[model samples]
Target: MSKNIVIIGASRGIGKELVQLFANNEGNHIIALSRNVEAMSEFDHLKNVTYKAFDLSSSTVLEDLTQILSEIKSVDILINNAGKLVNKPFLELTKADIESCYQTNAIGVMLSTQVVVPKMLNKGGHIVNISTMGAFQGSVKFPGLSAYSTSKAGLVSFTELFAEEFKETKIKMNCLCLGAVQTEMLEEAFPGFQAPLSAKSMALYIHDFALNGHKYMNGKILPVSLSTP
Candidate 1:
């Protein structure tokens, strides 16, 4: 059956690849959200893909999202791939840095999911939150990810609690603690660090997970990486 899938942060990297992968299926209807929608205009010709410009951290996020959701009516899957990474030493990080990271990575996911849950409550749905291995306690520590990792840890905890709170409703929620992937975000955060997984490759795995994960997975923090962590 065709599904209505909403992908946030769809302008580049994994989110962009996901839009391409889903659009190729033809049966799926995709709504791509990004801060700069113009970057996604290349996909405008595809009938299955619709693009929207919105910032996750904006004060008007809920209002903007509600307007978008109104057109779709129901959402089958929500991919919270939007994130902000501030690469600064712990001592150098400011209050603004931490707040910005939390706002975009943790709070944004909460607000967005809240808006979509009611629509998915009756029909059942899946939510895939994009997280990083940095959030893992045992993972190799990077020097400049204090705010980024802390914010992601908050999201991990939020996903766990949200799953329990809505378990009876059959809305599956999972966090994918991903390893380093070759993307613009990674390059910006760690210049010249080569990750084993490419955005396209990782997107393939995420594609399957988003479509079928609800069948057996809920509240699971699954790691997708080659390194031991």
Candidate 2:
């Protein structure tokens, strides 16, 4: 059975690895969405994969998604993996910084999922939101991630709300709060921090979860990390 999977923020890091991992099976059709179309050119050889220029922060996200999803009849899985990390002191963070974080990490994900939900309503589908440990309650909070963390917390909230709203339906939504993982984004956020999990390793877990997790859970916020807080 071939699955139609849509991966947001698929140009790099964990998102890119997820696309690659899913594509390896050759039975899944993948739509890789990200702002960086060039970065995903590495996947041109994979016939099952397609890349689209997607910007979650753009003012035209809805319009953009309309055009992108025009031809797709159904989607089995949607991975909201795109994120914007703004690391700055509490006072140093400007309105634009905070807005950008929320727009991309929260609003964009919700809006994007809004359109895809229709496609999955009939057959049932899984929507996995990629969040951060900084957003998780009780997790050790970092100082400079005020904007990033808060916005991500919104994603966690959305998961529970969305699940309840669609409980009678087959669509299941969940969020994963991730700790440190070695990726370009991680390096940029923490200059010299050594993360125990590689992007591929973390994506491996997410990949499986996206495929079969809905059978066991819905609207759950699970933490996927190698270390505590």
Candidate 3:
């Protein structure tokens, strides 16, 4: 049976790889959302993939998302992979910078989930929130990631709370606190710093996790990384 999977920020990096991985499978239907719809043209040939233009940080995101949600009867899996990263010293960070990071990483994710949960109420579903290792309490902290880390930490908390709130229900939520991966966001955040894992590799794990994670894991913040950080 083909499962309906929705992935936000699917135009690049791990999100794009995830779309390709799932779309290649015969029994999966992928709905990809990104701000730049044109960037997803590469996947247009895939019969199972559908792309939507959406800006999570926009003020009308909820309204725009509701319209998109109306077209899909149900969602089996929802991956919140959209995030914003601003590399600036804490003292140099502006109010807009922090707000932008939180709006995209935390608030947008929450709103999207809220709209999708009802669709999964009867059929059951899973949510995978992409976070960062920096959000972990004891994890090694990186400079210039104050806003990003803090916003992701908020998401980590929301995942736990959401899972617990829906414990008796068929819906499950978990946060994947990822370590550095070789992506544009990583290079921009820490230039020249090489990450051991590639975006494709991480996407594979996330794909499996999204499909089977609810079986044994719920309300967990699983860290994906090769090193301590």
Best by TM-score: 2
Candidate 3 lDDT over residue span 1-229, tens digit each: 5899999999999999999999978788899999989999989899999899988899988898899878889999999999899989999999999999999999999999988999999999999999999898899997899999999999999998999899999999999999989998888778899989999999999999999998898999998888655
Top-scoring candidate (lDDT): 2
Give lDDT: candidate 3, residue 123: 94
- Backbone clash numbers for all candidates listed: 0, 0, 0
Judge candidate 1 at residue 204 and give its lDDT.
Answer: 98
TM-score of each: 0.97, 0.99, 0.98
Candidate 2 lDDT over 54-160, as tens digits, reads 99999888889978999999999999999999989999999999999999999999889988999998899999999999989999888899999999999999999
Per-residue lDDT for 1-229 in model 1, tens only?
Answer: 8999999999999999999999997999999999987899978888999999978888988888999889777889999998899999899999999999998999988999989998898899999999989997688878899899989998899889999999889799999999989999999988998999899999999999999987988999987888647
Instruction: Quantify all predictions' global Cα lDDT against the true fold.
Output: 0.91, 0.94, 0.93
Pairs in clash, predicted candidate 1: none
| Descending-lDDT candidate ranking | 2, 3, 1
**lDDT of candidate 1 at residue 155, scale 0 to 100:** 82
State in Å the error of residue 3, model 1.
Answer: 0.3
